[model samples]
Target: YAKTSRTELLHFTVGGKDAGWMDKRAFTATLDKATYSKMSRGAKIGDAAVSSKHGLYTKPNNTAEDGEKIGLGSLYANQNVQIIQSAKLSTGVT
Candidate 1:
């Protein structure tokens, strides 16, 4: 896994299609029917949570982005938010 951030777009290797944005962080696109079957509970995308029983990227986090408002929150913490400002990504995590 690339350990993609919630906002990073996922590209499919088998379908040649951009799986789409990680809406609320995607553990998996649950691509093919077979792929969906392979996952179990406890999987997650970003700050979003996965399905209760079916962990294979079943449910989406459903957290919407706060548009033009003042609040107590971080940008990168949201799905699909750019990390260019929050942290640096190099060849390694450490």
Candidate 2:
């Protein structure tokens, strides 16, 4: 595990690519690793900028159109899912 310190830099990967330096002026809080990377890299599989203040490297989120890519959200490991409705878009009886 990495040491605990305010200066402790976080290292992560996006779409199999490594994240670069995250310094004080480079990155800030409320910017989670995944979210930050996505914003920075312009929501693509490689490095780019989503906003002036955020750098990311992945597709930000999913719309109904992202059928094959929907599984990307599942990479979070701890995320839990439960179907709230049926294929017919009716209230599930179960």
| Model 1: per-residue Cα lDDT over 21-88, one tens digit each | 44345453322111112323342225433222223212222212322333223322223533221211
lDDT leader: 2
| lDDT tens readout by residue for model 2, 1-94 | 2345666555666799987545443444342122121122112231222122332223332212222333433243343344232222112211
Best by TM-score: 2
After TM-score superposition, the amount by which residue 49's alpha carbon in candidate 1 deviates from its true location, in angstroms, is: 44
Backbone clashes (count) for model 2: 10
**Total clashing pairs for each candidate:** 3, 10
